[model samples]
Structure formats: structure tokens, C-alpha cells
Target: MKRLSTLLLTASITASVMATGCIQPTGDAVSDAIPTAQDVRVNLPDSAGEAPAALGEVSEYYAMTRGITRGFNAGAGFVLVLVHAIVQMPPTTVDGNTYTWGPGSDPLDPADYRLTVIDNLDGTYDWSLDGKSKFDPNAEFLTAVSGLAVAGDEAHRGSGEFTLNFTNMKALDPIEHNDDGDGTITVIYDLENRDGTAASLEMHIDGTDENGQAVVADYAYAENQDGSGDFQFSLPADVDENGSALEDIILRSRWMADGSGRGDARISGGDAGDEVVEASQCWSTSFRTVYETSTHPEILPEAGDVSECAFADQDLPELPGV
Candidate 1:
């Protein structure tokens, strides 16, 4: 996912195309209008000069598919791990010193929420997910990720493996199922900023249940499956000629797709060499919550499990170039 995201970040630089959402423009050609999830479902009809099709719903069709049980997750081509889990673990700053969960979020014991990740093979993905909320004991901020899968197209279908790194966040609240395994869900999380900008994940896969027991095909992070213009989105620290602090994540790669998907933010001065930053926008589509204290006990399967599982009704970004 990181690699794919990176490819998406980089894809902006080559050529631009307006994908459904998340667009960044360069000059006067750039319109002030940014695409949003709302624009697609509600506004598209009026704007297009024709009656809009009765699109099901924003979250309905827009839902991201992270599972790979169907195509590439099978044979030797690729083992795409599509993860769609919110980072529930909280982070804290005590006395000015930032404390990061060294390895992962520690158990407060009697964990109310329990998270489990299984694949198409009827087993677990053998990956550890948690929150790094240690510094601020009282206040909680967290991040979480879970089960991911992907399949290649008919021609280039193959298996590929990737890892997810949730940066700058808090703790992870695990998801527990009912008495039987049917209710057990990996993670259905959401997080966003005050502006309604955020992140959302929906992953799928097919593999074993127990950890380290599955045969996963790990593929190298390749840019633009079609050509070199594949790298889509990325965030980095600056390394200018004289060097400066890390800036925001600038939107690079072109919006058009040669298999290049539309990404959220970008890093300025990407061509400036070694310069990067986290975009100022709220790039996460998920909701905001303190996993443990969330509606459900620590973690419960499915968003509905949480009594107050509310996803923000924000608009999706527009890609001008594509």
C-alpha cells in the first residue's frame, strides 16, 4: 500500500488527469473547484448539463476495495495485501517530549476491543497492528491498519506484497466479533481533521488464519504498472541545497492514469530534490474516535458495532489533469 501510495504520489508529476476525486492543478488552468465525495454523488448531475444518473450513494460505489482473494492473491504473480483499517491507537506529547509506541500499542489488559486479520485461505495474515499512544496517558490519539488484498488485471495479473506504515497518530482500538468467528472483523476505522478531510480504508484478501503460516508473494514496488508514470502520492522531509525543515506532503504525479490512480496530497519542490512534507489537507476519509472509549468496547467487528460510528459526509477531491 505504501509503495502503491508512493507511486500514486509520484504519478502526479508525469501527466495530469482528472480522476473522480483528489486533484491538484498547477497554473491559471487550475480551477478553484476541488473535487469532493459530495460533488460526485450530489453535484455531478446538475453540473454535467444532463440529469444525473441515480448513483447509489457516495460511500456505496466510492468504497475502496482492499481485498485480493479473487485475482492476484492466488498464484505466483502477486500477493497484494489491501489494508483498510483505521489507526485507533492514540499518541501523546508529555512535557514537550513526543513518546512514540516503540514497537506498538501496549495492552491495558482486559482489552475490550479485539482485532483479528484473516485471509481467503481461511487464516490470519500474520501481521501485527496497534496504536502508539504512550506519551500522553490521559489524552489519547491513535492510528491503525488492517487486512489488505489486491489482484492484477488479466494481462499483467500477478501477486505483490506490501507493508503499511501509519505515521503521526495515536492508539489502535482492536475489533472483536460475536461469540462465533462470523462476527470477527479486522478493522473498520475512520479519521479526519477539523475541516472534514480524512482517510478511509476498506480491505479484502484470501489466505490463512494463523500468523506466518501463509505463502504470500511479495512484489517489488513498481511505478505505473503500464509505464514509468505510475508513482502516485508521497510525503517526505526536505533536503534542499542548503536544507530546511520538513514541509507538507506535496501532490506530485500526474492525475491521468496509465494505471496511475488519483491520490490526495503532494510534496512541494519534488523536482527540487530531497524535499518533502505532509500535505496540509485532511487526506484521511475515516472518522474520528478514540478506539478504546469509542461506542463499542475496545474493538468490535464492523462500524455498526460502535454505537456512535459516524462517518463524516465530506466531498471527494477532483483530479484536474486526469
Candidate 2:
């Protein structure tokens, strides 16, 4: 379903916003705590906290969601189309300022997704599927937008909202399940720096899955000079099968420009209330391979490894207009 795609798109936007050029801050408390680049040891909790054992599933859900929301081909409000994809189809028709896809083409096909972008001409533009297209048959979750940077910096930025309501949304990965129900996700993205500098990106998603379970998230990203950064993402008060409020779920990480980083995933307030279930290997430059530190062995038993640090070779998603 489009909901999964939208979720993945949000994740990609988050990574791109964080990877923008290094920006110098007048004074940032978060930067002060970062170990000097020469320090190889990452400071983290030696053991798990008081979070409940059930948090393992919550953390996995969030992790799987993040993984699902990465690496989409996009450009601001415009769906960046590859020249090859356009060439393989019949000639496109131009009417006024809009371009319509040829007949019998699947607009949702990554290669043939049909969309229309209307430039407002005042440093802003609107993007959406063609009204006549099947993607908008019922006129739901139709458009996205982009414009000035949220921070008034030289970096490009865009902000918009999307509503996803699909009964048959398919999960792009085996670990992910399309159990999400009708809902909306809002994203605010900052243009990445062409040069190293600080930038900001944020997102919020609130809705229920098919099972009617509440799905809520708050994500924030901040960068320091030298292209290093910090991030915090939380999913608060997810309900367990027994209907008790599980603890607030949180994932926090810090990284240096040279690929060294630290991270911890914690669940606070559930049956096992308040414990750290996942943590990274400090001083290690590896990406996303975390160790299970939770007292509850099954919180994330299937998570063979937990690595969140991005490798130097990892490319940021292409935010078309930016």
C-alpha cells in the first residue's frame, strides 16, 4: 500500500536532512558532550534499564518502520522521473502546464508513476497525481509540497502532509508487515547543505493499524559542524495485547563525521518498565549492529544485529529540487 511507501519516503527524507552540509552553531549543548574525534570510545549505558521485556517488539516495529521508510527516488514535490523510464513509453502529451502519462500505463509503477507539479512561481510549488488518474480516483492522499527552509538558511527545504488509507498496502521487506490502518503522516524537511553545515529535519505520524492499535511517532534530527549529527525518535505509550500502556519507546544516537557513533534503544514503562534493550558498540565504526543488553532475552530475539551508524559510502537520498 501507499502507506508503506509514504513511511519509507519519510525515513529517506530524515536521512537526507541529517546528511546536509556541516553547519556551525553559535552554541549547542548537544555538541559539547560529543567526544572529540580522536576518542575511539563511545560512552553508553553498561547495562539495560528498567524497561519491560515486551519492549522488544515495540523497538522492532519502529526499526522495521524506519527501514521501510528509506531510499525513495524523489525531488522536493516533484517525482523525479528517469529519462530511460520516460523514453520506453509512448509519447507524453502536454496540455497547458501539465504533462499527462500515456494510456495503459500504471501510474504507481516506479517507472511510470503519473504526477503533476504546478509551480506557484513564488519560490513555491505544488505536487500531486493527475486528478483523472487512478491514483486519485477517490481523491485521497493526493499531494505533497515544498518551499523555503524552515531555518531561513541557504539550504533548501520543504514541508507537507500525506494521508495514507489502504487496505492492501504491501510491506517492502520481510521483517515489515502491512498491518497499518488508515492514517496521516506529516514531514518537515530542511534542504541539505551543498557544503558542510548544520540542518534540521522532523516528522510526526499518528494513526491506528488494522488491528486498531495506536501508532504514534515523534522524530527529530540535528547536525553539528564537521558533518556529524544526533537523532532521537520516540513512539510513546503503545498498547500491549493486555491493553496496558507499554512504556514510551525511544532510540537515541550520536555520530562523528568519521563514522564513529553511539546509540541506545530503550523501553520505559510496561510490564518490564524502563530498561535499555539495545545498544551499540562504542568506538566501533560499524553501522547498525547493536548488542542485546535487555534483561528480557526475547525483547528482540530475532534482531541478530543492531547497527544504526551510517557508513561513509552510504549515499543520501536525492531530494530532487534540493
Candidate 3:
């Protein structure tokens, strides 16, 4: 079984030493069978000199809200993807006064931040598009990655050594905690450590963001704006100022529910007139997909059968050409 924790470190967090930074219960958490932070076992870094002394607060723990956890899982297990803008820097104000996160003149630390994942495989979750579901990061995905981890251990993370080990990381396959009506996945970046430790970074599979909410970002023909019509676009010359070859006409649309996980919006680009997406931005655009909930094999083929497949290596023609 994989360790429950993974990775997440943002630009601001990296500025410090750099510096650093789920889910619980089944459903609405009718059963208070959640795990407490104090009751959990974690590994703290060795007591150093300036690092430990700089910390004002030591250890902390908190509980996870389902909504927040769902956001985290939507990040597609990539911390960098979610940290879109720097937003307010660390030590940024909350209500009005400075919202002190942890230690240091800044808001994050790097030398001492570790995520301890407490994976409790209670029931089951399905992140599949069709209907197939499996066990994945377990409750920890939704629990620890959310509020509880920060509220509880935020102080310890920004500076001092904080270890988060979710020993119970076990689930069916890619199935995780939250369940959006659509097949979209959320890749959360709750952890922010420039040089610290990323115990669990592979939790997110991949997804899209409709304005803000994450969803199963997929591909469809594009002729117009509403995701219906034709599928052809034209570009201006000198599109490749950087000279990246820039041959492929890549397009992207974050299939995230708009308004912070409420509605769905397909921010796509085809032959449509909307040309806000310059060529440079399109380079990062994902053409196919990495992990797909829509294509999970009902029955995983035998190991030998998959190994023998030879045509998999050849660059098969794009779906368009076919």
C-alpha cells in the first residue's frame, strides 16, 4: 500500500528555506469515526538550531471539510497546477489585520514540513467516469489535505519539522473520497514547501476547472463557443516567437464547474473567434489526457496480455486523422 501523503509546494513557499505548508468520514460524516491529530503518530525533523527556535507555535491539528477536500482531490495530484496566482502573499491580511500563518517575517517555512496521512479505508469512493470505482488515497485524501491538516499542523509546517504519515493509504484503484456529479477530478495543492518534504503528491490524477470548480476535463469537437458546431481554427503568423517549432495547434478548455464548484463551464478553443488564448499559452495545453475516469477498464487486462501489446509504442494517428 502507498503512504497516504504526497507533495505540494508553491512559489511563495519556495521563497523561504524555502518554506511550507483532508477529509474525513463517509458521506456527510454521519459517524464521528474521524481520527484526531494528537491520536496520530508523525515524524518530526531532528531538532536543529535556528529552525526550531524561530517557531512560535509547535504542533497543531484540525478537521477536514468535505467541500475543501473535494477541491484538493481535484488538483490531479499536482501541487503546482493549483497554485495559479500568488494571490495574497504569505502574511497577507485576512479580515484586515495581518493573518499570521506560522513563523518567520514571512508566512511559510521550508526546513520542517511533513504531511502525515492517516488512511482509514472505511467504505469506498468512485472517481470513475462510467461507473467503475475503486479505493485510492482513502479518507486521508479528503480529510488531511483539507482544513484539518492546516489548522492542526500549520504552525509546525511553516518552520519546525512536521511529519505527516498516513500509514493506512489503501483504496480500490484510482477511487478517492469526494464525488462530484460529473467525472471531473480535482488536483489540490494544500501543501506548500519550497524545499521541505512532499509525502504525497501523486494523489491527483488530472481534471479541469470551470472558472474555479474542477471537473472531468475532456475533449470534444469545437466549431463554436458553446462546445457545439464546427472544429477548425486559424492562427496569425509569428506565433512561434520563442521558436519552439510550435507546429501542433494545441487547444485547451478547463472543464471545471464555474463559481467554485457549482456550475460547469467548458473554457475551450477551437476554430472559434475567441482568440484570447495566445500561442504561448497553448503550449502548456494538454492535448490528450494523462488519467481518464471515462476510460477505466472494467476488468484490468491480465498482466501478460498488456505486456505483449507491441503497437502501443508507435505514435498512433490522432483521433482527427482517423
Candidate 4:
């Protein structure tokens, strides 16, 4: 998470330098041509600073949830960092409404790497990152990333969709240099509403995990003006020790500015057999469990007092892809 914050700051500085140094008085300014890092990046709630002294025990479940949150942020930040480094450079050529930045534009970029940005003339822009093909020696360039951004009100300039095609990029660069997984991760975001209030962002991942298993998941996050936020995601199915597929899992969590939060989880299908299990857990500012309950006691038994929860079960948003 600390690394993600650093990357965000670096991206901001890079964008500022590029905007000031490269953009000219032409009708199309670089600021208006490309999406800002904040416009497309995922924003999750911050974790509590330090555990309280009064809480003797910490909640492992809350810790796992926090880890997952950090994982998503880091994964998304990695692609955004690369995109900012390449696109923020001065373009090598501008043909009509399209701007092209080739290898020499950025010393850090590969000799074969190229980035193109096109103004669609309809309040939208399209961009693609291309690199030399590794599989086909005769092929010149293969697209690794592509996206579109819709021009919105002043408060929400770049609000649209973008995709990172890891499978294609991995074919050119090794998985270690590109991404851990193979396939695509699409992000859709709207930074603000018509009233200028913070809106929502979503990510859909259709890919293979590091272990080569198929993974299909959706994540949604909404922010509140008071620094509180909500996060929801689906857990990909896994196989048990006996090689039997486990159930599908969906979890939603909400946190306040003080770091107290609650999470609700639903498990069904596969190894869950015929019954659907529902569970809820709440943690304090110290990240210690205050209350926990489950419909299926065999899976998760009740613990503590519900009165300690900051938010009720009904407060959580509907689980995505439920």
C-alpha cells in the first residue's frame, strides 16, 4: 500500500512535467488528450493507523480482508505506473487528431514500444500501447493495452473504460516484466456525479491466476465525502484437499473514517452442498473482532455481541454478481 501511494505521487509529478514541457498552444492540449491517473485509478479506504492498546486480540479475518484490498490496489497501480511513464512523454509525431509516441520519446521504454492516442472528435479519446511480437518474428507490433475515455464535466474529465491485455503483453514480455496473470483486466470509473460528488469505480478481471487456474472476479468501490468507503468483490472458486471444487464466495465490507468496519459474506454452490451459508463480522478501530455470526454454525459460529458493530448487515451494498 505504501508503494502504491508512492507510485501515485510519481505519476502526478510525471503528468505535471509532461503537461508543462510538451503541450503546446495547439487546439489539443495534452491535458485534454489523455486521462489523468486519478481519473482511472482505484481508490480504497485507508486502514487504521495503529491498533488500540485496549484490544488484546486481533481479528485474522479482518487482516485477510485488508490484505486483499492492498493486493487489488497494487495490481492496478502497476499498470497505471507503466502507462503514465510511456504516455506522458513528448510525442514523436501527431497526425490529424492522433498522437504517436515512439521508443525514443521515453528513454526507459523499449526500442519497439509505441503509444498512440486518438481524439475521436466526439468528446471521447482512444489509446493503445503496442510492442514488438515475441511469437511471430515477422510481426511488427501487437497491442498490449487499449482504452477509451469520455470527456465529462470539469469535475470529471476522464470517465470511461480501459483494458489491460496481459495475455498479449506477456507474449512479448515475460510475465515477470508485464503482469503476474494472463488475460484482461478491464476498469470502468466515474470520478464524480452530476452534482460533483464522489461516484464509483469498478474492475472486472477475466484471467488466469499465477498458478494457471481460471479466475473471474468483479470488484466495486464507492467513496463517501467523509472519508468512509465501501468495497465488494467475489472470491474465485478453489479446490479442497480432496480435489473437489469449493463454493462461490462474495464479500462486502464497509469502513468508517475511524477504521471500524463490518463485512458480510455469502457462500453457496459446490462444496457448500445444498445449503447457502451467510456470515457477518465486525471489527473495532484496533481491528479486533467485536461480533460475528453465521447461519451455518458448522461453518462459522456466533461470537461476541452484535451491539458492538459500527454498521448493521443492511448497511452493506448488494454483493456484485450475486
Q: TM-score for all predictions?
A: 0.20, 0.45, 0.17, 0.78
Tell me, by TM-score, which candidate is best: 4
* Per-residue alpha-carbon lDDT of candidate 2 for residues 1-322, written as tens digits (9 for 90 to 100): 3344434433333333234442332132211211111121112212333342322322333232234224111211212222112222322344453333322232243211333333343434343432122433443322222212122223112222333222222212212334546454444544343366555555556667678887776665556556566566665544233566666556555556654454455655675565544422222332334333444544433343334323322222122211
Give all candidate RMSDs, comma-separated: 25.9, 14.8, 23.5, 5.4
Quality of model 4 by C-alpha lDDT: 0.64
Least well predicted 10-residue stretch by lDDT in candidate 2? 33-42
> What is the C-alpha local distance difference test score of each model?
0.23, 0.37, 0.21, 0.64
Off by over 4 Å in 1: 1-145, 148-225, 249-251, 254-322
**How much lDDT does candidate 2 score?**
0.37
Model 1 per-residue lDDT tens digits across residues 93-122: 112222111232213421111222322332
Better of 1 and 3 by lDDT: 1
Name the weakest run of 10 consecutive residues (lDDT summed) in model 3: 256-265
Ranking by lDDT: 4, 2, 1, 3
Tell me how candidate 1 scores on lDDT.
Answer: 0.23
Q: Candidate 3 deviates by what RMSD?
A: 23.5
- Tens digits of per-residue lDDT for model 4 on 73-103? 6655555556656554666567899976653
TM-score of the candidate numbered 4?
Answer: 0.78
**Residue 52 of model 3, lDDT score:** 23
